[model samples]
Target: MLFAIRFTDHQSEYNVRKHYLNYHLDWLKQKRGVVLAAGSLREKHNDQPVGALWVVKAEHEEEALSIFSDDPFWVHGLRASVEVLSWSLAFEDMLKD
Candidate 1:
């Protein structure tokens, strides 16, 4: 199964986000195969990062949530909220592999 996890940063948590970014990335790297694609979400005007998005492969929703729960960002409370949803690919160019 595929899951899309979206994290919304807490207001004024830029510093916190930056602080844990390396650790967060490292954690993601540790789960490289399960993480299909991931990136920071940015504001259009200034391109400031406001959140993160991750597409992950998991057996079920609980496993997906476990992955999110293990993220350093989530452990450190950098997020204001998070949403996890099952995703069905209609078509893919890059991530098809």
Candidate 2:
């Protein structure tokens, strides 16, 4: 199953996300098979990241959660909350094979 995962950033400067950024990227690379896509969420006018999003392929919601729950950012408390929803690719043809 495909899952849309959103990791909302904690509204605090104490979240230490930048400190573990490299480790997080490394981990994401290792999980690329399951993590089809990922990136930070930002406002329209500014470049500040408000959260992060990922598209994951997993057997179930728990499986999807586990994939990101192990991320360095999550382990270190960069996320305030997370939402997992089953998703379908509406523009599949637009993507390269």
Candidate 3:
């Protein structure tokens, strides 16, 4: 199933994101079940990344959460809040292999 991971950084904790970006990218690359469609969730007016949006395919929610648990940001307690929801692809022709 596809899961949407919504995360919010702690007070000014976005700094951690910048520091661990390369590690996060490499980790994602190693996971076959995750599709990182969008990394930067920008503000409505200005171009700034406040958070991330990702699509993950996993057998269960626990499996999906495992990925986040290993994230450097999460490990460092930089993420103040996170929400995971099952996502559906209504129309995704471009996603076809």
How many clashes would you count in candidate 1?
0
Estimate, for each residue in 1-97, the C-alpha lDDT of model 3 and write its tens digit: 7789887767577678878888877876776446646475767757556677777777889887887788776787667878889988888763542
Highest lDDT model number: 1
Off by over 4 Å in 1: 92-97
Model 2 residue 27 lDDT score = 97
Question: Per-model C-alpha lDDT, please?
Answer: 0.86, 0.84, 0.74
Clashing pairs in 3: none
Tens-digit lDDT track for model 1 on 4-95?
Answer: 99989886877888899899989988998898899989888568788989999999998988887778888888889988999988866546
Better structure of 1 and 2 per lDDT: 1
Candidate 3 Cα outliers beyond 4 Å, as residue runs: 45-47, 92-94
If the candidates were sorted by their TM-score against the true structure, best first, what order would they fall in? 1, 2, 3
